[model samples]
Target: MNYFNYKRRLSSETRIGDIPLGGTNPIRIQSMTNTNTNDTEASAEQVIRIVEAGADYVRLTAQGVREAENLRNIKEVVRSKGYKTPLIADIHFNPRAAEAAARIVEKVRINPGNFVDRVKTFENFEYTDEEYALEIEKIRAKLIPLLNICKEHKTAIRIGVNHGSLSDRIMSRYGDTPEGMVESCMEFLRICVEEGFSDIVISMKTSNTVVMSQAVRLLVQCMDKEGLSFPLHLGVTEAGDGEDGRIKSAVGIGSLLADGLGDTIRVSLSEDPEYEIPVARKLVAYIKERENHPEIVAEAYAGYSPFDTSRRETYAVENIGGENQPTVISDRSNGNFELNSHFLPDYIYVGKELPLAAPRAIPSIIDVEGWKNGKNTYPLFTSVNYKEIKGNAATIKFLRLSYAELTEEVLSLLKEDTTIVVILTTSHVNGVGEQRAFIHTLMNNNCKTPVVFNRGYKENETEDLQIKAAADFGTLFLDGFGNGIMLQNEGSIALKSIDAYMFGILQASRVRTSKTEYISCPSCGRTLFDLQTTVALVKEATSHLKHLKIGVMGCIVNGPGEMADADYGYVGAEKGKISLYKKKNLIEKNIPSGEAVQRLVQLIKDNGDWVEPDNN
Candidate 1:
């Protein structure tokens, strides 16, 4: 709870090139170009497009000396065109490449894990002190030159830490966690400070939104306690495509930004990096606007679902447990309504349910028939005005049923007293002459009793009335948006689907291993082995083994380092064989790729002494 009240602010006086980053400046939005670095022309074209699209800063991954070689040309291309926007060189696995980029780009991103390993770059430095001092000296020998070059060129440097590429030493000590991530970054930041450079920016990105959020929270808190501060670039790394990614990014980034936390953001997507620009801009804009509103309260609760995930009705209703919903009216300019101790459902008041028009099948926003202007067809969401409703007890109806049997079954489930029901149709006859005769007839014939006890709409949404009604009628707002309701008696909403699988895999991070937990990372275009299938098979075959941690990583390059603390980890180091590790130390093994999963799983089970249950 020490961190609950901790309020560490980033240096408002910091700068990222010509764009001021901290010190009461506007929070920035950033994105990376995926164009092959080898293509200077193509990369330059994308940079110009990205600049025109409102990206504050653009990053280009410099894979090696050849890629770093394009830095000067790419800069010339942008600069010759009079584009002065800052360019960041994302240097991973090689500090020498970073050193080369330091002379050209406005910013350089270096992964500390890979940077420290190239001690040969700093072989000229000698120290008679212990290994720690020697390591620090060597680290400085390599980084100081790059820092000096950046300083001489008036460039800025940001240390970007992806949890997927964390250090082996840190992972071995703290486990792969938010705290471990913070520790790793701090070690790098300390070096940055020790070298007498405070003009620094830092980032911590994870595929898990929750961990990303929590990591920022811990970083700000821990640094505040230690009286160290830096501008933190926030992002949910590898967040997938379209609606789910957008929602998850919003919930994770929005929640923290709401608390006055981030300086810049990137929403990593699976496809076209260009798509990331608009989303990042909108995310920053939305959070900034929300900060000025007085009615929004500090989030004092948890299990916050930003979108509907429940596939069944019983699960959702059971979670509400008949809580009174605060009525949030869209009209707040005049403060016309004073909420006393009295509360109701978000929309309905007294005994009435609020009316919500359902979303109907319409033209797909992205027009899935094909891509736009000869682009591939992807799903996009059209805007809706429902966000104007500011109450928890809003009554939403899912209409335009496709099948009569499903509709009847859904109706049977909705009739329960789990929440107050309203059968009233769209009849204006209440205050005016109502004429919903056709819809009324259908409702009456479908049920022995009225589906909704009462229904009405006031100008638009009656926030006070709806909130009071939902509270009075045993209804509550759900964390997610959905067409159908869930009736569940448990807490955490279980996720399903490929998207949910990744989200759930990330969610497993919070489940503190009372024992062993299985961990795995997704393979990217660079993966040499069949990491995805191997991970699935390992998880499937060894899922019954409890109270132990097992990790299936794609390559030893970044995998062994990230999963250093796993009781056992299977890492593909070569095409035909893998290297096994028992909590940071590599165990003796040369299992062929064919039998890796079975051998790995069996070793884990035997190590943990897991016994299969007998079935009679």
Candidate 2:
């Protein structure tokens, strides 16, 4: 069987400084400097460090004309140090700054949400089609000068779109959706085309993984229709630090990369910028690894549309799907461990047939041949033998079907048992896509049986297991193909680690939110205080606030825009002060850093978002 081949998306190659993006170039890695742009020495030093850490391109926030003008000194300093890595001026709401940076840096990125319009002014007005055209004309008129400057300086431009920051004009028409995100970019893209500027890249970013993924796909589809093949820059904006952040970034960015969609990628973690490069590299390396796998030829029909959210219709099997949150399945199916509530799985597949007592009340799935007359467990039947087993009084049963063994008989057998939940597996190359195709077949045939996505890996190395399993399972979860996830390795990884990864993937995909989310940015020279230490302190103080999102920013430049999704924000306001926000509303400013955490707790408590840590 031939495997699914990832043919890179065709895009116009654009050069940034000495670096090239799109076309046949290897997918590039990018990171932004958190430093103040006016601090030329600090900014240049951070850029060199980012380059040393393997960033192909570095971006600096240019909020005003001074920072934009300072790019000259920053560029000179880095060049004097012999670092030719492309420096991009990140501009928002200021066309003049973009103009200045265009002449100074290799590339300039402007947000379409605010380049010409006053953002977050909360203006609401219904624009007629003519009014909309006039708005575009205004934006085009404002953009032409910067476009000309970029063209003259041979600078590339990235028209990045954020889901949270869509202009009121776009919101009135498109309602803050993936369609709106694409249109936001299209508005600018059309101007670039009209101005005869082809050196362009684009991004559709959001903290929400699903929206980010959907928006990017829609952008590609829409751009394709307009005959535009600009390169894509992919990232999950303001993804928080730690494993949760990593998993979320991987799922969103990796899913698209697997489909061969991204040209340059940045893993936006609330950690040091250098820390992001390694994660991005790991994801990019998976593309090469996929190419080396054995090819499996199969009809591609993932039951769900990758471009749109169409969750498969599944009948409720107790607590698995139909209304319940997606369940997590862990296996002691191959090893011996004491099952306790701390590491409890919703369901378990028994590894050995020994009737050993467990530490808690948990359901188990017993193999057909190993089944007893009155065992208090569900039976697991393979595709070939599932039809032979007599239906039991048990309300639920397990029917395991491998894609390699699926056939007309299996499909027919699957349809006959509404009580049987299908456990879908694939031992083929491109397993994720294969499993997706299997689900697609089931849905096409109108089979509504809930699916449990199951995969086993031979690698016991924890990091490798986590990344590979995440790439395989994350894409499926994002596409809405599974009701539950069951993962196994050669028994090398800890049960608790696997458990964490399972929930982490589910949480990161936004299918479930199980913990407090932090949106921290990588510290840069622009940061007024110690970001790494500050984030650590914030997490330590607020980690127990489950499902609450907190943004810890080093400075205000990109902080406000990046942390748009955070429920509350703790941002550095000045050299020794912090600002607090209640969902983008500034509530306190210039609070001494010494008292910020304690004061934040009080604020959370006042807003009824605080909960005492569990002590039981």
Candidate 3:
């Protein structure tokens, strides 16, 4: 069997300008300069930096032909100086800018999100079906000439779709469902196809990594079904700077790429775009090694999912070979407890039906060895009183040591510089009050780089850390496993059961939902229809959005005010109608709930702009 046959296969030789995207090409890495396009020297310098750091292609915003004028000089100077990396122009709201850019750059990224139509008020939100068709035609009119110029110049186009700037009708109709996202992709693809263009790339992005992943999965699924295998560019948009962005990007992009998806990938850190290349290279290498080798995959699968069944667990590990092997480093907790890089956590799904009211606080930290393959663990950085022992041993209780005993005297004495996994277990250690006190002390201590503990969900919060953990893999976790240790100290596996009690506590708990947390009132006299049923239905319908936070409130007086943080909302209003909101600003007056979800999903799907609120 072909090694890359299990699922989606990214094109190995696809092109985006001179930058080959997939099919057989090296996975391309790209980033965009934050420098204003008009600043030619600064932008060119930054592009040079991006190239030196391994970026295959770099992009600059070309909002208009005025911007393109500066780019011509910038692109020329960069190429003349000996760098041949491709230049891509990101154009929005203006097709003229695209045409100008086609004259100088090798690629152009057209954000369907911000591009406008002939009559623009409707660009702000969803339209009636007739209105939608009319607007689509208007956009085509604006875009086709740009497409023709790109074709003539042999430049590539990227129909980059995102959440914040979609057409109004898309949001009104689809309300952010996977269906909505795919519809938006198809809508643009169909138009591009009609225009006789194929040198294209596609992407759907959101700030939420989970949602981005879901949108990608849906897009790829549809593309495969339709046999339309255009190259894909993967990204997690608006992802924060530094470590948080890296983790989120890894989860979303890495997860999809791991499953044999993604072509050219970008890890959108708020840092210098030049910093994106190394991460991109790492993701591709991991995927390539996985694709070319089999035993490595099997070995990784064995470690992450040692279960006897053939079913693929949340993560499947294969010891596939070459330099492309998955990163799995091993060290033991205090020298005796063995730890794998992929530490698997046992989980179960305990839905909203928690027979009785449960504990409010759950474990949020995990302390254990490293996580490799299917093997997973959370590290906790809290203190423990287990007896000190030599070699691998679980000291059930170790106490009677004052802070004075834990000084330099104790630090230098017990086998210095050893790895550790403090397994917090109920059977081996039990004391909530003591555990709480230890948690405070641990947090107050030196930074706990990798803290793992018993993590569970609050019936009230719906989507907390545990839910977040499960959501990272797109699965609902119900039960927690004893492998529930957090990496409180450094080293993936640290010796010494310093705080195994926390692990015991966490593994004993349960999990809830992941990402796109929803919080709504139970509803009262202000309620028009059944608020109970509405909340349930909306949750059921939009549960898969994964990256958006939605709120369903009752009553006009408080609904919008309460959900100031919601991405999309439905508030009860007078006459069995409801108000729609995006953030704190209300975008629409009142629409029937019967069609609200569908409408909102579509709006979000198009990566469209919000319709101006109807003050009346």
TM-score of each: 0.54, 0.92, 0.54
**lDDT tens digits, residues 1-616, model 2?**
1115455677889988788999988899999988778888888888998899999999999888999999999999999988889999888889998998899899999998888877654456799999999999999899999889988999999998977678889988997689989999999999899999999999999888888889998888888889888999999877777777788788888788777789999988777688888888888887656665555555555444667676777888888768778878777766455544443678777744536753236777777677654444767888667775555656677888877777888788678777778888887666776787787778778878889999988876665666677777888888887898888777567777887788778877777776787877666655778877888888889988876989888776556655767889998899989999888688999999999989998999999988898766
User: Residue 299 lDDT in model 2?
Assistant: 58
Considering summed lDDT, which 10 consecutive residues are worst modelled in model 2? 1-10
* Clash counts for all predictions: 48, 16, 132
Across residues 556-598, which tens digit of lDDT does each residue of candidate 3 receive?
Answer: 4335533544677777766567777787567777788787777
Q: Candidate 2: where is the Cα deviation over 4 Å?
A: 1-5, 292-304, 338-343, 354-357, 373-376, 458-462, 523-529, 554-565, 573-575
- Choose the strongest candidate by TM-score: 2
Error of 3 at 196 (Å): 2.4
Model 1 lDDT tens row, 1-616: 2111222255535566788776677788777876668788988988888788888898988867778878789989999999988888887778778888888887888876667753111113333447546565666788888888877877788887777666555545565687878887887777777777877787877655556666777777777887777887877654444433454455556545655677877766544556677777765664454332323112222332222222112222221212211111111112122322121112211111111221111111121112132111112111122122222132332121211122443445434333322222221211000112222223343432222222232312222222222211111111111211111111122211211222222223222122235545433323346654676576567655655667766555555555644667887767678877777667656678888777776766667666673233
Q: What is the C-alpha RMSD of each candidate to the true structure, in Å?
A: 16.6, 2.8, 17.7
**Model 2 accuracy (lDDT, Cα):** 0.81
lDDT for each candidate structure: 0.52, 0.81, 0.52
TM-score for predicted model 2 compared with the true structure: 0.92
